[model samples]
Target chain A: MVIVSVAMLILFCMIYLIPGDPAAVALGPRATDAMREGLRIKMGLDKPVWVQFWNFFFAAWQGDLGRDVLSDRLVATVVMEQLPYTLALIFGGISWSVALGIPLGCWAAVERGTMADRIVGVLSVAVIAVPSFVVAIYALLIFAVALRWLPAIGAGEPGDIGDQLVHLILPSLAVGLGWVGYIARMVRASMLEVLESQHIRTARAFGLPERMITYRYALTIAILPTVTLLGVGIGQMLSSAVFAEIVFARPGVGKLVYDAILTRNYPLVTGAVLVTTILFVLLNLLADLIVGALDPRVRSRL
Target chain B: MTVLSIKDLNVTFSTEGGRLHALKDVSFDVPERRIVGVVGESGCGKSTLINAILGLLADNGRVDAGSITFEGEDLTRLGPARMQELRGQRISTVFQDPMGALNPVLSVGRQMRNIQYRSGRSRSEKDARSEAMLRQVRIPDAQAALARYPHEFSGGMRQRVAIAMALMMRPALLIADEPTTALDATLEVATIELLRELQQDIACSVLFISHHLGVIAELCDDVVVMYAGEVVERGTTRQVFHTPRHPYARRLLECDPARQSGRTRHLPTIPGEIPDLRQRPPGCVFATRCDQRVDACDKVPPDVAVETGHVARCVLAEAR
Candidate 1:
């Protein structure tokens, strides 16, 4: 709740910080001063900044974020329309990253100091070092343009699950690839540490199969930090998804916010920021719950 | 008959400095249904001996030349599958830190069940056996205790649970590596007592390792005294504690606070450092620290059999 409020205030402050008049942006340079002033008063920009913020904050509490100045549609509706695409992209990215990262991590740790471990170490560092936007562009060029495999632009036709899924692959890859390296490196480091821990030794001492010890005993404990990283990674992925969306020309809340910022669409921008912040907080909460379930020590504390 | 026998064990670790002679020509036997304690200071290679026996030595460490014979099989030569099969069912271990020995995330029941993974028993049967073992170790509310995490238990209780898990399969041999060192003084005695009672109940041979001489003296039937990486003395607890033949053994016993006759400002300490194990010493490992060192002490000491069962690795023992 506190985070949402803070994010809301920051978003409002951002509206003021950016050098543009929504009325002028909406009416264009041809509009007279008298007409602009009338438009500003109607849009509540004529009121004190605090008053405008308080009115918005009060209305936001009741699920009212006004409407988009350009389209005159409810800000909530516009954000909601774009939310699913961003969400699908984020979730798809996270799923593949975890699938690839965890096993790679476990394998690296098990074969530590060997060629396999070294390869994973080098690859993970390399992937993590490269910026997501660069990956986004290259991925677009290769998978979408050069290879002619996936669609290069747009989010595909709406109401078609198959089309949406096909469109989701490259953007998800661009957003999630870095996280794969991040998760792999995190899991590997954590697994190495856990494997050295006394409990792991105890398991080995008891004559448990090496496979069981690695997966059941070591991985369970090693994966805790990775869970936390995923929560934070999602938020970062949402932001980075903007680059993928812009390059891929996909419709998403991130792209919506970026376009809104350009046109000085205050209601839409604030509404999208608020919704994503809430989503980030909720995802983190889920991660904490998962951690608690996995680790009884954490559960007991909770 | 011996339940576990380590003969001519030569374990070394590769470090940045050089190859560390952590254990050299070390040999001992854990006789059936007997408790043999190995006592030494930190870095005395007690842990290395345990790891070697369990075949869980660190990647850089190896058994260069050794025969760890458990039952009729040479364990050092056993394949990983065979070693794993023998573990928990035939040989089990209780580690030093009770808190660390058990997985914190798992319930006590879950870990105990895991210990019996090779049993091919039903889950309920394992749970029932785990509960019974907990009761044997005197953990209150044994059934409920199984569901609780290690952190929920006090240190002593956790150690008791560790003991229960170790003895659950009624392993023929149990290796306890300073299991009571992490507990409080009162709890340590209680844990030792519980271990002895459980050992007797299961009739398992135990190779217990500790630096605590008092604990060894109280609980062990036979005792091995180690200095640096080599065993300096071995005998019945009475023989070693009452009549330690090696100078290092005598100094170690004298350093025990309980053995000191009266109060003094200074605690008795052997006045020298352990020789660097990266380079194996040609002479007695403890020769530099021995107050009774003679010209012959500069040579590798012979194993002098003072009695039928008592042996001391010192030239003076033979002279005496």
Candidate 2:
């Protein structure tokens, strides 16, 4: 934990040293030296880079990210208010992918030579081959604009969670579809290897129900590797939700970071990136602990 | 009453390459409390025959023509769901390698209890029954094993768990496919001894598959010798082993590395590859490897009765 704090301090220093002026990037390059220097002082960018970094770090440690330059509100206020919409999509999207992909992948593995297996195999390959951007746009064009079934953008009336869900559907489907294919194919391969195992045959020999053999004996073992992949996929989703945020016009970290980057709001941009990196690391650590708990060998060792 | 009677059984498998004749016109009966040991080379379809009996053959494989009548119901005609019901309750199997035959994730107790519960016992009743069966199999630390997964148990201990699980429902027939193959010499002897003791206690018919003639010699009352998918000899263990009438059986017993008296038991080599299932010789699958093969052996499929209760599928045995 101590090492982590020290590492973060180093990372902050290194990030600040990147070429180009925050003042020039924040205001346009057309600004004179006097204007740049004056703005830098006000923003605390005129301080030694370490001082500016420490000022932001202390504020972040206190759970106050200062204010968004343009929004003129606390960054925490923006994030906490906006996070639910993104998280709803992330949670719903992941739940749908696992529920659908696991059984589908198991069936595909168990019935390898059948038409259903071949069709699913081909579809998984096809979905993965196509980019998430293409799927999101096409879905939005068809379901939102073309049919008018769903609102094309906006998280809906700020007070209504149900309306927010309706708004999130298209973008979630878009992101989930890309990852589902890769996950399904990987699960199928693992399931295939496990189903042929002698333990599975022994389970069959014992006259356990077909479902028991397929799920308890076979699928349970096959799912461990997929569980690990799901963790990696969650990280993938956050990084890639930029497209989703843009398409849905949702107020989330993705959009906030994009805007911050464009306007060269150095503190806000750095804060967003730093938060994302920390979240990514935390998610990985949490997944590792979950997997270790699920696996008896790891659990016992720990 | 007979527990399993397989008559004129033939199993064929369809592969991308061609039709594979995995089992050819094989027949045998496993009576109540009797032990039937099937000895053969690896590819001679012993495992396939056992799988066919269990109705667990691969998608491409099928019992092409056969009648497996167990108790009163013809197992060959039973629906899959019904077959599954019969499997654990009335018929169970002990697989070849204990390491490969047990689920690594499950505690031995859970695996044992699952079979009992699945076969219609209540959870509490199932737990009692499982513990009792483990004791019956003579597992010294069965209670501790119950908390541990397959990885924690030794190979021999794993086999004991398997045997206990197989006996959970007191199945009428137990198909043991090379159950000792994964164990060391001492454990092999010990496991078969435990199995012999099990046969006495529960009195269920056990069909043992093995490549070792020595094991069959020790355990089975009846021995079935198969070569290239065909049962070349079948008889009482005494008649078949001592007064072996079939030349293939003779050559097989001769090739038994651990059989002959004296230094290292002189493991004799059979001098030919076991014929491929997809490309078996027309008249005799073993004739290619037989030293005493005659033209008549090449032309005719041999089916000879050596005694009223014993049979040998060899033309020479019937010539007299």
Candidate 3:
């Protein structure tokens, strides 16, 4: 865990050392060369790059993300307020993946080579092959514009979480659709192998109903692999909030960092990056523990 | 009366490639209340023949040319909806692996009760009947075992559970396909004895499929030896083993080391694998594998009467 934190901290410093000047970017097109230089000196950006990087990380450690140069707002405060919205979007997407992926996988497995299974299988493969950003745009155009049922942007007020969730539907679907295909295929292959197993044949020989043989025996064996997917897949689904948040222009941490990087607000960018990296690392650790809980063989090793 | 009468039975599966014949021109009959063992090598169409009789063939599997007459009803012609009524009620099977024969996630009690109630048991009657059947299978700790999953039981216990499940329906005929091959020697004998005991009490006929002629020798009253998708011999177990006329049946018995009298370098083996169904030879399927091959062996062997109840598809036996 400490290694992960230190690794992220080192990466944070390296990104800041890149040659491009964020202060110059912040000053924008209309500013004179003398004025841009003056602003850079005032913000302490004129210092050696290493020194500037150090100060920014120090402020990040102290929770002093500094003010966004353009908005004149505290970066730390802005990010904290937006963090929940991104987390919500991520959770929503993962929930959607789990809700649809498991049952559909089992269904495809039980009804192997059937018309419905074939169609779902093909659709899932298509979902994975096409990028999520494309799915977001198409879904937004269809659901928000063509259908005209949802508000296009924003997480809305605290009390309006349901409406915010409604707005997130298309973007989350775009983000999560592909994982369903991957997880379903994993499940289907497992189910097919397990269904043909000796015990299953033995069960049927006993005159057990088809439903019991399918749901009870075949599905239990099939789910071992699906549970394995859930742990790491959830991390990927939750952490990959950038594209969807950016496309929708939602007030999420991803968009906050986007604004920070553009304005040369180093503290906010470093802080957000650190928090995200840590969250993902911790999420992966939690996944390992949870998946281990489901499979005793791993638990025994621990 | 014959419980199962399969006449000119043929099974063909049309896969993505082309038509593949699985069973061809096979015919046999099971007498009422008797153990009839179908012994053959793997892929000799033993399991396929039984699956066709059970109406449990997969999507691509088809009964290309045959009549499976069970108690006067042509099962091959019965619609799926009509077949379902008879499947768990009057027709049942026990397969190769006992552990797989029951649902891994369900309690044996639940599986037993489900077949009991859904096939027409009331909720109240389901429990009482389920417990009784558990005891009948001789599962120790019947109540606790009933509540446990299939994996919790030993292989022998599981097979007993499977046997109990099959007999719970009190079917007229039970088809078991290599049912104890996965068991240890001790469990194998115990399971076979358990099966015999159950069938003795239930008075149900058994169409037993296996590769072990020794098992058939001990368990079956009559035998049907299959080779390359057709029956090569059928007779009383005594007649088939002692004076087997068909070369394939005789070779099958000759290969069992327990029954071997000579210390030969190698066991007597039927030469080739079961012929590929896609390009079957024009003549007898077994002739390529038969050591008794002659010029006439290239011609289809007619089914010749060897005894009062014995019959064999062998050209050499005809001269006798």
TM-score to native of every candidate shown: 0.96, 0.90, 0.81
Estimate, for each residue in B179-198, the C-alpha lDDT of model 1 and write its tens digit: 98889999998888888888
Error of 2 at A36 (Å): 2.9
True contacts kept of each: 0.82, 0.72, 0.49
Error of 1 at B31 (Å): 1.1
Residues B140-175 of candidate 3 have per-residue lDDT tens digits of 877777767676677888888888888887999998
lDDT (0-100) at residue A206 of candidate 3? Answer: 47
Could you give the candidate ranking by lDDT, starting with the highest?
1, 2, 3
Which residue pairs show backbone clashes in model 1? none
lDDT of 1: 0.90
Residues B34-61 of candidate 2 have per-residue lDDT tens digits of 9999998878888889888888888888
- Selected candidate, larger lDDT, 1 vs 2: 1
RMSD in order of candidates: 1.7, 3.2, 5.0
DockQ measured for candidate 2: 0.67
Per TM-score, what order, best first? 1, 2, 3
Better of 1 and 3 by DockQ: 1
Model 2, span A1-302: residue lDDT tens: 45446656776776577667777875676889998899778878778867887887787777776667665677777766656666676776676678778878988987888999999999888887877778878888999889999888877888787897788788888778866787789889999899888898888888888787788777777888887887778777885577788877888777877887777566676666656666666766777887776667667777
Which stretches in model 3 have alpha-carbon errors above 4 Å? A1-83, A98-122, A183-224, A263-302, B15-19, B99-102, B105-110, B122-132, B262-265, B279-283, B291-298, B318-320
lDDT of 3 by residue, A203-301 (tens): 554445677778766776677767666656755664457778888777787787777776666656766766666666766677678666644445556
